[model samples]
Target: MSEAPWWRGAVTYQIYPRSFMDTDGDGVGDLPGIIDRLDYVASLGVDAIWISPFFRSPMADFGYDIADYREVDPLFGNNDDFDHLLAKAHSLGLKVMIDQVLSHTSVEHAWFRQSRESRDNPKADWYVWADAREDGTPPNNWLSLFGGCAWQWEPRRGQYYLHNFLTSQPDLNYHNPDVRRAVLDEVKFWLDKGVDGLRLDAINFCFHDQQLRDNPPKPEDKRVGRGFSPDNPYAFQYHYYNNTRPENIAFLEDLRALMDQYHQVAAIGEISSEDSLATTAEYTRDGRLHMGYSFELLTDDFSAAYIRSTVQNLEAQMLEGWPCWAISNHDVARVLTRWGNGDASPQLANLLSAMVCSLRGSVCVYQGEELGLTEAEVPFEALQDPYGITFWPTFKGRDGCRTPMPWNNGINAGFSVGEPWLPVPAEHRALAVSLQESEPGSALHRFRAFMAWRRTQPALRLGDIRFLDTPEPVLAFTRRHGDETVLAAFNLSAQPVELPLDGIAGATPVNGHGLAQGTFADGRLSLPGHGALYARID
Candidate 1:
C-alpha cells in the first residue's frame, strides 16, 4: 500500500510571527526569534508549523498586503534568516508552511504602480481597472471588505481599480494570462526555498467577474458573518460578482501541478464565500487543493449540535477531498473566550484540545491556545488594526487576539525588551510559559499530553467518523480505521451529566492524558463539566 501524505491527519501549529517572540529587541517577532524557539514548538508534538505572512509589505494589512513576494520584510529579517529558519525547522522533524497572499497586492507593489500609471503601460492590465460612470460614482455598488466602495479612483489611469480588501490592497486581474503566470512563478520561488507547504491566503478571491455588476442586498436573516460586525456595510450585500469566480478552479489545477513536482509538498486553500462549505469542497476535489478550510468552525456558534452538523455537512459534500479544521486563528477571537463563555480554565482548555483533534479532519492549533490564553483587552488608543479603528466601541477589532505571546512575567512579558508592537495583557502575563512550566496541571502541560496521546490513536488520526445520537449537551462519536475503532465523547456544558452507553460493548478506557473527571458503571457514563472520554471498542 502507498504511504499516506504527511498532512493527511497532522496537527499544524499556527505561529503569528509578529506576535510569537522577539529576539532583536525590535518589539516585533522576527525570523531569528522563530529559529530560537523551534525547540519549544517541536516539543508540542505537532507535525508542522504554519507561519503567517512575513513577506515584504507596507504593513497596510500587517503583512497581508504584499509589495514584494521574493523579498522578506527587513523588519522580520533578510532572505538568509528565512532560509536558516526553514533548515532548522526541518531538522527538528517539523514541516514549515508559509502564507501566500496571491489574490491581491499592496498599492505600492511594482506591478500595481506600473499598472496604475497609464492605460498604455506594459503592466496596464495586470490589475483590475474600470472607467467610472457618467455620474462620477464608483463603477458599481461593490463594497470593500474594509468599508465603502471596492473601486478606488486612480487619477493617473483615468479609471477606478478593484480592491476587495483595503484600498491599499488592489486585486490582481487573474483574467490576464500573464497575471496568472506571474503569480504562479512567485509561488514557485517559495517552493524552491525548501518549504514543505503553502497556505494559500484568500485563495477563492483570486478571480472576479469580468463584468462589474452591482452586488444584490443580502437578506436580514442571512446577514451574520464570522469576522465582521453586523452593522458593517460590507455584510449587507450578497457579494455575487465581487469574488468566488469559476476561473479559480483552473488556476488551482495549475498550482497543484506545480506542487506535484516536489515530494510530499502540500497546498491548503482558505475559502470564504456565501456558500463557503460548497466552495471548500469544490476547491479540494479533483487534485485541485490538497486540503481546504472555511469559517464554519471559526464562528461564534459553540454547541454539540452545531459542531456535529458542520462536520457532517462538510463530509457529505466533500466526497474525495480532505478538510482542515481550526477553531481559532489570527483573524478570529480566541476560541476559549468565544465558546467558553469567558472561561479560560485548564479543564476547559484540555477538553477543547482533545475534542477538536478527535474530529475527522486535520487540525490547526493557534498560537497560545495551549496556554488557554484569553483575548487581550487593547484600549482604543493602543489599537493598531485598521478594522478596529473603522468600527470602534461598537465592535472591537481583532487587535485583542493579535497581542504578543507571553513568555515570562517580566517586562513586556518576555516578548521583547522594547515596547512591543501590541500591549501584552496582564491577564495573559499571569499565564506565562515560565509559570506553566512549573505546574504539572497547567493548561500547557495538559495540551502537550493530549497531543502526544492522540498521535498514538490511528482511529483519531486517520479514520471515518460516525457521530452518535446523544443528548443536547453531550457529543459522542465513533472513529473506525481498519481493525481499530475508538469511541469519543465530550460534555459541552458546565453541569455534570449522565449518558447511557447503548449498543457499545467490549470497550476499554484509554488513560494518561489529563482529561476531566468521568466514570463508567452499570452501562451508564457519568461525566463532570467539560469532560472528555476515549475508549477502544472491539
Candidate 2:
C-alpha cells in the first residue's frame, strides 16, 4: 500500500518526559534528552512520537497542571531545547506531537492567579469561580478526581473555585469567548513551532454547566473509573454539570479550524467522557477533532469478548470519525502486568502488539511497552504522585506506571547518574533496552519486526475490520482494503482452539510471530494457545 495518510494506521510512541530518557545529569528527562534519543525512537519504526506534558508547572499533577502553555518547563529546558528536539525528530523523519492540556491550568498560571486575586481583576472571570452558599458550602456538589469536593474555597475572593482535578489545577471557564481565543492561540504557538500534531489532554473537560447547578446523583451502577476510584465518593454523582458540556462543540470546531491551516498537522483529542467511545465519535465527527480515543480498551479486562465488543461498539457508534487506540499510557497500569498472567510471557506481549496494530484506528505504544515492562512497585515512603499519596494502598494512583524507562542493566538503568526521579523496577533490569537489543527473540525485537511487517499490509494500514463468526477463545477477523484482504485470527486462551473459516477458502500462513504452524484444509485452521495467524486471502 502506498502511504495513505500521515495519521491513518500510523503508530505513535507516547513518551512521558519525566520518565523517558535524561540526556543531562538532571533527574528529569528534558527536551534536550528527547533530542538525544530521537534516533533510538525512530529506529523502532514508529511514524510519530507524542511527548507528554513538559509545560511550566508546579508539578502538582506532575506536568498536567500547566502554569504556562506557550513556555516549556524549566525542568525540561527552555524554548531552544524544544526547537532542537523538533528539528532533530524531523531530521529523523519522525513526526512530533506535543501534549496539550486545554481543560485546566495550574493555580499559579497568570490567568488563574489574576482571576483568584479579586472579583474585579481584569482576568477575574477567566477561571470558573462561584460564590459559596450562605452556609459557606461550595456552590455545587461537583467532585474532584483527586478526591474531596471539586471546589476549593479561596478566602481571598471568599468564593470556591472549580477544579475537576487537583485544586491547584483549576478548570478554565471555556464558556468565555476570550478563553477559547486564548486556548486557540496556545495551539497556534505549537503548530507554528513545527509540531506535527497535538495529544489533547482531557479534551472532554474543557466546558462545564454555565449555571452553578449541582450535579445530580448517578444511579447505583452507572459509575466507572474516569480519574477517581469507584470507592471514592467522587464517583457517586453524575458529572453532567462538571464536564462534557454541549458548549464544547464550538471550541472543538475552533480547534479544528486552526489545525486545518497547516497541512498534515493533526490533533488527537483524549475523550475522557462518561461514555468515552460515543464522545470520541462525537468529538471527531464533522471535522471537530482529526481523531480521538477513549478509555474503553485501557481497562484491566483482557478478553476476546471485551475487545470485540469495544471494537464493534465503536464501529457502530463511530461512522465518519476516526479513532486512536492505546492499551497502555502514562497514567494507566502497564498492560504487561495488568493483562499478563503469572508467566508474563513474551507470547502474550506479541499478541497484544499484533492485536493493537490490527485494529482499524491509529495506535499509541508507550515508551517501555516494547520491553513488556510491568508497573513498578512504589512503597508509601517513596510515593511521588500526589494522587497516589492521597488515596494510598486503596487506589495507589499513577506513580506505579511513571517509573523511569530502563535503558540498560547499569546503575539507574542509564536513565540518570544523579538518581532517577522515580525508582526503576528491579524486575525490569533483564528486559532493559541494552539486553533486548542483543536478543533476536526479545519483545523489543518482536515489536520492531511486527511494525515493519505491518507497513506492508494495506488491509492492516487503512482497511476496515470485519469480525468473523468464531467460537470462544478464538478471535477471527478480516481487514479488507478494496479487493486486498488479510485474514487475521488469534487464539486468546491458554489451550488449543480450532476455528472454522467459512465461505472463503485457500488460505496460507504468512509466518507471523508466535503463531502455531498448521496447514489450512477443508476451510479450517488450528491454533495453539496464545497463537496468531495472518494470511493474504485469495
Candidate 3:
C-alpha cells in the first residue's frame, strides 16, 4: 500500500489556458499567465496540473486541433515560456500534464496540407482518405460529433477525408505505421522536455474502421447520454465504426511502451464512444493507458442512486485498471449548474468536490470549480465556440462553461485588461478569488481546506470503497486501507435530512474540513442543507 504510484488516487487540477489568466493583455491566457499563477495552484493542494492544449492551431476548435505538435502557439508565447512555466511549477511541487491531441490535426498542418494535395504523394496516405460513392455522396453514414457528415471532400485528391470532429480537424491515419511513428515522436518531444503526464484528448478516436462501415441506428430512448443531445444527428447512431475501434488497443499498447521509457510520466485517456464506461475499462486494462476517464458522472443525473449505480458499474468491471474521475472539464457545463440544478451553493460545491474526491480513484478538478462558478449566459453574437454556434438555441454548445476566470471585480474581472475572448459573468466576479480568500466560508476556502485535510487521511486517499444502501438524497460509503477505515455520508439536497446507520451504527466524528458539517449521535446522522459527515470507523 505504501508503494502505490503517485498518480493512484491523486488529484489533478485542470487549467483551461485561454480562460485561466491573460498576461499580454491580448484577451487570451498564455503560458506566462499560467506561470504567474503556479503558486496559487500549489496552494490548492493538488498533486498535478493538467493544462489543456496550447499547441499551434488554427483556433477552429480552439487548441484541440493541433497544427504543430512540436512548438507552442505564438498566441501562448514561445517554447521558452513553456520551459519557464514547467520549471516554476516544479519548483512549487506541482507536476505538469499537457494535452496531446493525436487523433486529428488541424487542416493547416503540413501533413494534412500534403495529404490533401494528391493521391500518390508520400504523405497522401498519412490521413484517412476514401473515394466518394458513384453518386458523389460521402462513402458512409458516419456522422461528425460537430454535426453533418464526417467525410469532407478534397477536390485535389478526388477523394474525401475523415474528420470525427470539426472539418478543420482532419483525422490522422493510425493504420499507417509512419503516422503512428510521427505521432509518437511528437509525444516523446514533450516527455523529453520534462512533462509529468499527458492528457490524451479523444484518444479512443485515433483509429477508424478500415471497412468504412455505416453505424447502426440508435433507439430514441438510448440516445440520451453524456456529451450527446437529443437534437444532434450524431446521437442517432450507435457509432460502432467511426471511433473506439478494436485497432486502438494495439496503438494504446504502443503508446504505453513509449511512456514506459520515461520516469514516472503517466497518460490519462479521455474516453467517449458508444459505450464509454466499457471502453474506459477496456482502454485502461493491461499495459494500455495508465488511467482512463469517461463522461459518466458529468451528466445531468445527480441522484444518489444514479451515482451509486454508475460508480458500482465501473468498479465492477475496472478490476485490473485505474480510473480518474472528473465532474467538469473544458467540454462540459459547470458541475455547480449541472448537478446542483437551480439551487447551487458554496456548501453544495464543496460537498460535490469532496464526494468525487472520496471515490476510489484519482480526481481532476476543473478550473474555477473551487470558486463554485456557474455556467455563463453568453449571447450568441459573442460566442467563439463553433460547436455552440452550430447548435445555437437548443444546445448552446460549451461556451457557457468556457468563459474567462474571474480573479477580481475589476474590468474583465481582472482576467484581462483587453476584452476577453468570452465575457466574464457578473456572478463570477462576485465570487472572485480575491473576495473568496477574504470570506471565511467561501467555496474557494472550503475547497482548499478539504483538499488539505484530505491529504492527511490515508484511507480516504488510497482505500477500497464500499457503498452503503441509503435512501434518496443520502449517499453513504466506507473506505478502508490497512488499519484505517473512514465512513462518509452526504445530503445532496438543501433540505435537512436524517439517515439511520444500519449495521455501521457508530462513528467517531472527524471535523475541520470546512464543509457544511453534520452530526452523528445515537444511531442517526442529522445533516442540514448540503451537509457532509466523515468519521473514523474504528
Taking the tens digit of each residue's C-alpha lDDT, what string does model 1 give over 1-538?
Answer: 0267889889999999999999889899999999999999998989999999999999989999999999999999999999999999999999999999999999989999999989998999999999989998888999988878899999998899999999999999999999999999999999998899999999999999888878899888889888887678999999888889898899999999999999899988899999998999999997799999788989999999999999999999999998999999999899889999967787887888888888988888999999999878899999999998998888888999999999999879999999999999898999999899999989999988988988888888899999988877898899999899988889987789897978786567789767985766667777889887778886
lDDT of each: 0.90, 0.85, 0.91
lDDT of each residue in 345-402, candidate 3, tens digit only:
8888999999999998899999999999998899999999898888878888888999
lDDT score for residue 451 of model 1: 86
Candidate 2: residue 515 Cα off by (Å): 5.6
Candidate 3 Cα deviation (angstroms), residue 345:
1.1
At residue 267, give the lDDT of candidate 2: 88
182-213 in candidate 2: lDDT tens per residue? 99998899999899999999999999898868
Q: Which 10 successive residues of model 1 have the least lDDT summed?
A: 517-526
Q: Is candidate 2 or candidate 3 better by lDDT?
A: 3
Looking at model 1, residue 149 earns an lDDT score of 85
Give lDDT for model 1.
0.90
